[model samples]
Target: MGDIRRRWTVTARARSDRGPNGLSLLPWLLMGMGALSHLIQGDAPNPVIGGLGLFTFNTLYIAIVVRAFSPCHRETPLTWGLLTALAALTFALAIGYGREWLLLFPLLGLAVGAVVRRRKRLGRITVPLVLAVGVVTFWRDGWNSFGVVYGTFISVMVTAAILALDETVRQLRATREELARTAVEKERLRFSRDLHDLLGHTLSVVVVKSEAARRLAPHDIDAALAQVADIESVGRQALTEIREAVTGYREGSLATELDRARDALSSGGIEPVVRQSGPPLEPRTEALLSWVVRESATNTLRHSGATRCEIKVGGTPERVRLTVTDNGRGGDAATAGSGLKGLRERVAAAGGTLDSGPAPRGGFRVTAELPVETQASQEWETTG
Candidate 1:
């Protein structure tokens, strides 16, 4: 969940970085121009009513256009009221004067297309409603009124198409944002796993060797001195590994990590048992399994008060699996620490799954499964 929140934060920052140039009011300006042209050229029998009608129409048109561009697509009651008033005024102008006034009906269609909340409902209600108004107003003129029909048809079709194109662009932008977020998340997981694997293993070795030196200080000076020397050596090696990890050049192998886990567990006075029965794995699979071993060992040493730990590896022609279990004091696996969380993301990115929970008998268990031939798994194996 922290990882997810970080990704969203990065995405928001990226959008903000693009600045004010991302949006422009030019399209609305063009729409206003086209709508205003109707009022200037349109015929008005009763100047007062016609002028008032044009003003209301233009005001409603602006409101509808603004709402269409809003992130939310749903219409409010105020919008419905505006549309209803516009329609009534358009109808009055058409009936009192001439069908030329009916041309304004097309603007109403455009407004309907822009302002309606639901698409399916818009298709069912708005389209038929607009068509009916156009037909009823022009029915007296017969087939000779081609201008009225063409104008109405063009207005509705063009406006609806524009709205659809706008919607498509919105969906594309959203998809692009999701992809960016995923990429950021994957990179963060990689860095976290590298740091945890490096430091956790090194620190566990240092702690164990330090304890041994303290215990042996009086019994045998030579043994105590040797343990101190070993601790120094381990600490220096950890420093080098930390540097490599930070520079993103460190890599782990399953065989090496397993050996290291055995040494760390033995130093901590815990028995280590490892079992393996797998076909040869690709380097990527080996690397991922290595990190799993490293993290599990660290957890057992730091948190699990266990006496024995078991690491198992097995594979079939189709998939490979790794499991780490310990006879430790178990806790809620759902609330795993950052190391396990990073492991989950790493495994998932490789087309694999990781499951951790209380073992059926006792203690805690972590399992990872990776397909033998997925593209993502193959890519991870090669690069990981």
Candidate 2:
């Protein structure tokens, strides 16, 4: 029941979102005009019964219009009873008076509009029921077949088409909402992965420096003091990096990450070698590559037991590449972590690819290739 209520609420909101002022009531007003014309035509045996029937039909018509346009429109036992009574009244008026009373056929359409709220088996149930009503009401005159058929066709078509359109709009709105949720979830995952990588690398450096200070405290007081100072500096830097990341102001550059990676590798007792053979890159491309370096360095420190690590950056005119290789116990396909997965998503978003595997000569290698010439770059070149 709660699910049904929620669905109805969503449908109502979608319908209301169609326009600022809400759906136009012009059609119902036109229907009122047609009902007035039936009164003006003066084709009833008794004016009193005709007037009463007219009033009842118009009242029920207005009720139907209000219910159909309502945002919270749902079926209830009372509503069902009202629709049943209206149908009975309509049939009674047509039977007692002449066939002219059948001009109130729009009331049947209104009933159908209400019925569809509870059951959408419109073709199987409502359509046939409406046809049966028409047959019973007009069976007295063979010539009245055309009016019955035309009336039933118009009522069914109009009601079904409007309801279908409303359902479609509701579906589209739901799809848009779902897509928005997915985008936000992806961003949250990216932020979490970045935080993990940043803290993991920073804390590892801090731990190594603290351990060095502990070992050297008695032998060389100056060297121990220097290690403690380095630990303090690393902690402060980590704090600042975390602040920047949380505020969405943190942006990585290739040069900065490479320098930091070198320091981290050397602190972890691994020799670091860096090489570059690329022209200047766009800021976005640089940031993406910087992230690749950061994630790779973190993985090397945490997973790879290596004595040496090498970083390479190279590119042609069309694309740029970054490779981080470590002469460590190599990782297999199953060893890829969340940091690597996040890196893959980021690189792909920038129209790039990331590949990681055990290198041929032993150890693990991570490679990222990003296009140098994006749409913005092409436009700049053309304009220049």
Candidate 3:
């Protein structure tokens, strides 16, 4: 019983793996058994000629049907040439031996359907072929042979439909897998961008505060202690933000980012000026702008030797704009840094634009503008 069950399982698996192939059409060759029997009974007029013709017809049939399953070979001139020769041989046998030989018409139809994929092309080939079969059958076996014509037509249409649907299903499966891979890549990119923005700003703040504490320790113990306490607070906040980022649940706040920017700028000995004016912003907009603020402030502290940095945000209810400018020698945030480059892609995905370069007067500058409403923002709001 175990051996039998294993055999059955293997058979089932083999059939499934075969899918649509030449073997599926092989069974229909049994229809030609009638002609084979005539030769065996010695009823065929030219026994040797009949035998040779039957051998050639079966050979061509096998070649056409087998090649039909391979898309690369199906439409080749060689396959078409084989099919054409098969058609000629089928017609010769059916006309010469009208009784059992007429069954070859439907088999011919099956081969045509397997090779021709497009509906327009199939119709062009099969319609005339069906009419020819009807005329020939009328000549050989009269109206009683209408079944041959009907079978021929049905064979062509049904075969084409099944194969077409199978091809469509295969294409859909491939497309679905491609989309899944693309989604995974987008998620990885999002996580990397968040990590860069978060750690970049947090570490800059820590370093600046540490420097301030070190310098103040000799002169003012209380002031140095205050800086130390601020560092502790920033460290804890960074930990929570890092956790949130890891889980992909972190959301940014423009107000919180601006406050941190002020502290960071002060610790770095750079004067900070921040101004905001506009209708209340959407949370999504605030979040994007918050990233801009953090990156810009970090760059200003690290690269721009400026003593003063100005950050301004203003816009209407329909659009929002942000600009960060500094008075140092100007060559920092605008350079091709991964932080700004990734931030640019993030803004563009949300249907916004970011520009960073040297300001006209004498400083590095970064500016971003976004619509108040966006498709991504709406989806995020709805899901949240």
Candidate 4:
């Protein structure tokens, strides 16, 4: 936007390289005719007539310069160039028959746009430059000449208008771009979290199912086939969930995560117990806790050698908690693993805290607590 306003500012003073084109040629032609008369009749010049001719010079030269200057901000350069040509024809009319007063309209527009852009310095510079010349011609023509009065009024009004409009445009454009950038950043964050969860949980399940199939293959062929079938079915479901996550269409259920965890543990010969209490969850909190359950279950199936697992989820109006504990031949490896680290990140992002380590009583325990969601639901019900 600064660039846009600056362009209009620079154009006011800039000169063009080429001869005026299209309609602009008319002004130059008429200016040339008048200048020809001025040259021939130099010996006996009337002050009024001479001032009028000089005023025409102002219009002719400005038109030539404005037309030549092109900004790539809009339509084809050809369109701007054609507009310049049109201006030149207006300049010719001013020189021939005092029509230079018409030129004030565009100048007013440009000036108004510039002032709006907060280019006070540019306005100061242009105002004096145009006024000084217009004033001098007005005085020369004795202040009563219609051409002098009209041209001066028009130039001042048009220049102010252009300056104001230009500034307004710059500010609007800047705000629009900022909004677009913020939207993109938010979407990127969402996709990153979704991809991390999808791949992490799915891969863990795949590892566990593969191990189950391998162990059962030697003695129980039917069991081995069943394990393989579960692996395939689970993988397809994971892929579908990933597609939904990317599209932002589905809100997943906590029950589904618990169901998957139960299947993986039962198949691996571990006894699984689930105890859930408290009022029903708001959809968002349920989805988040559900994710925590899935991750914990997957880690247990893939890494823990525990035979007994206990999962408990309970909450009050102000907070919610999820705990997964396994009584197995415990080791420090799972605590130091990548799966737990990723889970910690997801938990933090959801405005919660996760603590995972060996339980003093027997095996390993993972616990997470979220305070904000229940508070939000309480607020909603009260407000309702």
Q: In model 2, how large is the Cα lDDT of residue 6?
A: 100
TM-score rank order: 3, 1, 2, 4
Better of 3 and 4 by TM-score: 3
lDDT by residue for model 4 (1-384), tens? 999899977775353312223243234334244444544566324546645645664554455335332333222464445434434543443334442333342443232222223456446644654554355445444455445445445544554455345445555776887899988887786676677667777887777778889998999999899889988998899889888888876566866777777777787778888877665677777777777787777667767788988888876776788899998755675464465676677678778889988878878889988764444332111100
Candidate with more favorable, higher lDDT: 3 or 4? 3
Worst ten in a row by lDDT for model 3: 375-384
Residue 198 in candidate 2 has what lDDT?
A: 84
TM-score to native of every candidate shown = 0.65, 0.61, 0.86, 0.53
Which is the winner by TM-score between candidate 2 and candidate 4?
2
Show where candidate 3 strays beyond 4 Å.
Answer: 1-18, 332-336, 374-384
- In candidate 2, residue 129 scores what lDDT? 60
Candidate 3 lDDT, 198-297, residue by residue in tens: 8888998899999999999999999999999999999899999988988888889887888889889999999998887776677888999999999999
Evaluation by TM-score, superior candidate among 2 and 3: 3
Q: Which lDDT tens digits does candidate 2 get at residues 325-377? A: 99999966323568788788889989999999998899999999999864332
Per-candidate Cα lDDT values, in order, are 0.72, 0.72, 0.88, 0.61
TM-score, cand. 4: 0.53
The lDDT ranking, best first, is: 3, 2, 1, 4
How many clashes in candidate 1? 1
